[model samples]
Target: MGAFDMLSIAGSSMGMHQTWLDSLANNIANVNTVVSTSQTAFQTQTPIVRALAGGGVEVAGLALSDPNGRLVSDPGNPMADADGYVRAPEDDLATQMTSLVMAQRGFQASVQVTKDAQDTYRSALEIGRR
Candidate 1:
């Protein structure tokens, strides 16, 4: 592939990584939300990414959180049902944080690839000056 194609691949990777980071952030933010029932509880989200054969980016889909919500027993909580059980997303903050870190690392890697490719192309131009 040409230098331009390498650039396209890196750009697409960066875009997809951005979406991945956003989804992780949103999931972590909603970890504490309470719902009246498990069925209606907020669900975490994840981004599905696929690479194009030639070049560019394509989002496969958005994966939703698990259907079963975590139950917490707190009689004083207003949202609690008759059994003092409240429904919240089962998503773990720690897991989401870890995912965020991974996404950040991937983003950094893509950026480095792009920068390196750019430098290589720039250096190639020096052939004319020689």
Candidate 2:
């Protein structure tokens, strides 16, 4: 692949991972958000990454978790219903944390790849100066 192609691939990977990280952050942030039993709780979103026909990856779309969140008993909470129940997100903190780490690593790796590609390109230019 050409220097530009390598950089573009790395850039695409970084973008996809960044989007994934963003969604994971949102999910973690709203993990404890509660709503009235009659309302839908915050739904977690997952980024769907797809490979391009020529090269690189992209975030094709977002897949959302179930809207019908689990019911929790928080009698004292104002958002609780008459039956002392409220809707809480079904997101699992452990899963979200693990995904966060994976996405971070992926982003870092892509950055490294981009840097390496640039360094190689620079080295080629220096050699041509001889």
Q: Pick the candidate with the highest lDDT.
A: 2
Q: Write the per-residue lDDT of candidate 1 for residues 36-124, one digit (tens) a residue.
A: 65347778888888779898676788988776678878778888888988888878888889999999999999999999988988898
TM-score of 2: 0.92
Give the Å error, residue 100, model 2: 1.0
My TM-score estimates for the predictions, one after another, are 0.91, 0.92
Q: How close is candidate 1 to the true structure, as a TM-score?
A: 0.91
- 63 Cα displacement, candidate 1 (Å): 0.6
Find the candidate with the highest TM-score and give its number: 2
Local accuracy of candidate 2 as per-residue lDDT tens digits, 13-60: 999998999999999999999999999989999998899876899998
What are the runs in model 1 whose C-alpha is more than 4 Å off? Answer: 55-57
